[model samples]
Target chain A: AQTVTQSQPEMSVQEAETVTLSCTYDTSESDYYLFWYKQPPSRQMILVIRQEAYKQQNATENRFSVNFQKAAKSFSLKISDSQLGDAAMYFCAYTNQAGTALIFGKGTTLSVSS
Target chain B: DVKVTQSSRYLVKRTGEKVFLECVQDMDHENMFWYRQDPGLGLRLIYFSYDVKMKEKGDIPEGYSVSREKKERFSLILESASTNQTSMYLCASRYAGTGTYEQYFGPGTRLTVT
Candidate 1:
């Protein structure tokens, strides 16, 4: 069974700064995908970024990027120049090569302080 | 732009009542999913459909059922609602193609079973 773990239950960051949320997963499969999703107070879950397990290069979308270390089973999310709008519950997810349903970690609630 | 819509933003139902939650997607997606989100538990998949009239059980499928009579619509049903079933229900859809690991989510329905 694949399992994802997000160590931080709650994270606090300042506006215009940077914050990193740690996530680790256990999986035996070689080919899979990792993702970060943000759920705001509006109850909308938005895709922040994703990383392909086979890709050596990390995936970055605007100010959000992932440090995907497949060897260590560590996939962390880095938010550079964090904004107040970044305050939300962020989730780490995994899916296999066949595009099965995502397995998510316990979310980390990010609080952005001005 | 992928648009996924849930029938309600909030729903309150009594215990033992039959509840139905509707989800519709406009992207012609081949897969639809139902997930329940709880604090410290993350998002647990309840059910999923790969195609119309096809359904599969997920990690926590107990006390829940699904119907997918049409390609773009998926419904989650609670045969006998319980207080433990009170949580945020999220609906998602994805394409069954390359680079389609990302699932688009709708604004969730917060179901409260009293």
Candidate 2:
């Protein structure tokens, strides 16, 4: 079974700074997908970024990017130039080639301090 | 833009009562998913539908049932609601084939079973 783990329960970052949320997963499948999602206080969850296992290059979307280490089974999210709006509960997810459903981590609450 | 909408943003039900959570997507996606979000647990997939009248059980399908009578609508039903079922329910949809792995999510419905 594939399982995702987010070790950090809470992370704090100063405004205009950078922060990284750690994530690790256990999956035997070689071809898979990894994703990071953000859920704000409004409770609307949105996809932040995604990376395919076949791609060695990390995925970057605006201020959000991911450090995907397939060999280590680690996928981390890095938020650069973080702003107050970036404060939210971030979740790391995994999906196999089937892509039916996503296996999610426990989540990391990111707090942006002004 | 893809839009996934839930029937309610908040719901209150009594234990042992029957609960129905409705989800609709405008993207005509072939895959729809139901997930529950808790504080420590990011999200757990309950059920998913590949197409109309096609359903599959996810990681945690116990005490939950689903119906997909139409391509764009997926419904999650709780046969007998319990207090432990009180959580934020999220609906998601995505394209069923390759080249697209991102899933669009709804605003979510916070169900409180008292």
Candidate 3:
């Protein structure tokens, strides 16, 4: 069985500042995918960024990027130039090669203050 | 764009009532998933379907049932709803056998049981 853990339950970042949310996982599978998703007040799950276990380079999407350390089983999300719209519940997820449903962490609630 | 839609945004039911939550994806995805999101629990998979007429129990399927009679639609059922089941229900769909492993999610249905 695989499990993801998000140690931070809440976080606050000033507008235009940077924030990083920590995530860790336990999985025996060597081939897997890691993802970060954001859920806003609308209750929609939105994909933030993704990183493959085999990729040594981190993945970045505009302001959202991931620091993936496959050896440590750690995948963290960094929000650069954070805005008020970034306020949401962020979740870290894991999926193996079997294409099963994602294993999600408890989540971190981020609040961007202007 | 892949679109997944849930039948309802919010629902209210009484304990022991039969509840059905419907999900539909327009991209003809081969896999659909149902999950329950709770405070401090993140998202827990309840059921998933890989193909038409094929359903699999996920991490938590104790009081839940699912049906997938078509490729684009998946249904989650609670034979007897309980207050413990009151939470945000999310539906997701993914393409078949892909390394991308990106799952499109619905807006979620917030179910409140009294």
Candidate 4:
């Protein structure tokens, strides 16, 4: 069984600054996928970024990127130029090679201050 | 754009009542999932369906059943609602294709069992 852990329960970042949310997972499988998701007060889950375990290079979206360290079993999310809209609960997830349902972390509530 | 919609945004039910939560997707995805989210716990998969009339149990399938009579609609049922079952229920769908591991989610339905 794979388990994702987000040690931080709450985080705050000033507007236009950068923030990093930590995540770690335990899995024996060599082929897998890691993902970051955001949930706002609307309760809608949105995809932030994704990283393939086989890929050595990290994945970057508009303002969201992931530091995926396969050897360390760590996958952290970095949000640059953070805005008020980035204030939400962030979750880290893992999926097996078979594309099964994802296992998610407890989540880190990010509060972007103006 | 993929769109998943839940039947309700909020629901209130009493103990022992039978509750049904409906989910529909417009993307014609082959896989649909139901998950529950709590404050300290991340999203836990309750049930998933790969195709019509085919369902699979997830990590936490107890006290929950699902129906997928049609390809676009999936429904979750609580045979006997309990206070412990009260949480934000989320529905998601994903297209199983080459390199597609991201799942699109709907605005969750917050269920309160009293």
| Top-DockQ structure, candidate number | 3
- What docking tier does model 4 reach? high
> Could you give me the TM-score of model 1 versus the true structure?
0.98
In model 4 chain B, the worst 10-residue window by lDDT is B94-103
Candidate 2 off by > 4 Å = none
Report iRMS (Å) of candidate 4: 1.0
Residue pairs in collision within model 1? none
* DockQ of all predictions against the true structure, Cα-based: 0.86, 0.86, 0.87, 0.86
lDDT of 2: 0.95
- CAPRI quality band, candidate 3: high
**Docking verdict class for candidate 1:** high
Model 4 C-alpha lDDT versus the unseen true structure: 0.94
Lowest summed lDDT window (length 10), candidate 3 chain B: B95-104
Chain B superposition TM-score per model: 0.98, 0.98, 0.98, 0.98
Candidate 4 all-Cα RMSD: 0.9
lDDT of 4 by residue, A26-52 (tens): 999999999999999776899999998
lDDT winner: 1
